[model samples]
Target: MRVSQSMKPENAAKKLGILLEAAPESFREGTVTRDELAALQADPPEWLATLRREGPHPKRVVAEKLGISNSGLARSGITDPLTTAEIKALLAAPPEWLVTERATQAAVRAEKVRVAERDKERAARGASDARRSGGGGV
Candidate 1:
């Protein structure tokens, strides 16, 4: 006998681009098979399509669309999921908080790149020094 592969509802919801809480109770209570998940993505049902088009989007999606971080959304008191219209509205006329948060997020991304580059250089130097030292002993 072979075991069937399945994923939890939360994982399915993430893959489907909808909030787990926003999904129907029936969907929430059941596990999704890989085929079912793929079918849903390939030809989304009304609910999934609506959720993706009009959303109640997850924080990660919202953050990416808004060019900000999840923490920034929380800091701006946006605890609830936002619909597409609401996201567009913000983009059309960004508030002071959104402006500030975008800048902060940009700075954070830049710093991360800088740190990664520095770490890479350090690692390369260490490798070079190791090669020169010839394993330190015979």
Candidate 2:
């Protein structure tokens, strides 16, 4: 006996460029077969095409296209998903909060990289010191 392959609804929604909660109830209720998913991607149905073309996209995608973090969106009072048009409008005429959030996100990313590099240097120094002190043998 062979089992069929299937993807969870949440993953399908992500691939489909929509929030799971925004997807149709029927789509949300069932697992998607690999073949079905492929077909959807190859020649999407009206709903899928509409969503991909003119999205009420998920927060992650929204943040990516907006060049900001998900938390930045929340801090700017954007708790709901945004359509492509809305995203474009904001990009064309960015508000003060958006500008501030973008800077904050950049600083946060820079700080993360700085911390990671510092930790890597510390680890390398520790390893070098251990070797020089002949500390490995018990």
Candidate 3:
């Protein structure tokens, strides 16, 4: 259930066997952005926008306390202001898209297994019936 880059943190967490709850510190002023994201990643404004649109919490409350414009923060795409340890807490977090794709693949595999088992059972039953009727010609 790892979340991938394309997956929303919440969605990814669910798949990765991680639980998403209200972060201890709501996104407010003094909240430190993850250094890696701050350094390695830049300008996640679009993600912020998506979060605002999709999130359950109030975007304005989060933005105002953080001293950022609602639109600006929304566009910033900063999902969680997690520290290194907090980020690590997201066990097996894959990018969002990967989790979805992997789940889909697993479902397909399960279906195939089910179909194969059914076919095998049907063949076995048919063979048993043939034997009982003395239908096999030598």
Candidate 4:
């Protein structure tokens, strides 16, 4: 059966081997971004399954090894699943994926700062109201 585009990103990401822990920023912003797996459906189905059997980076290397264009991997609906060891290796030297890691960290920190600011603002508003109400005492 064919998967519909209406499927959620988190679900699609899982099928694509993403292991999403939280909602994506884009999705939270009222956009329906396709998960990596669904986006790859643009490619042929047979090719994607072939890549899954091969391994990670299978699209590029497997295709090269098989004498097919990398694009073929997308059509085949294949996704390279990351092992725990591989995840550890990538985190140890995240520099290889510089742009993404840095941007992710920055976004997280920004969100934290935003939350802190909001909390402070709310506290100030509460204090002002309390003072106006004569400390809520008899």
Predicted structure with the largest lDDT when compared to the true one: 1
lDDT minimum window of 10 residues, candidate 2:
15-24
The segments of candidate 1 whose C-alpha lies over 4 angstroms from its true place after superposition are 24-26
Model 4 lDDT tens row, 10-46: 5554455433333245533432345434456566255
lDDT of 3 by residue, 50-122 (tens): 4433343344444443434544444556455433333233325644543444455567668999999999999
Tell me the tens digit of each residue's lDDT in model 2 across 26-138: 88997998888889889988888787778889999899888899888888899888999999999999999999988988999999999999999999999999999899677
lDDT to native, each model: 0.92, 0.88, 0.46, 0.50
Error of 3 at 136 (Å): 6.0
**How close to the true structure is residue 19 of candidate 2, measured as C-alpha lDDT?**
79
| Prediction 2 TM-score vs. true | 0.77
* TM-score for each predicted model, relative to the true structure: 0.85, 0.77, 0.32, 0.31
C-alpha-based local distance difference test score of model 1: 0.92
Which residue segments of model 3 deviate by more than 4 Å?
1-91, 136-138
Q: Who is ahead in TM-score, 1 or 4?
A: 1
Q: What are the per-residue Cα lDDT tens digits for candidate 1 across 22-51? A: 888988997999888989999988998888
State each model's C-alpha RMSD to the native.
Answer: 2.1, 2.9, 18.1, 14.5
In model 2, the runs with Cα more than 4 Å from the true position are: 5-8, 21-29, 38-50
TM-score of predicted structure 3: 0.32
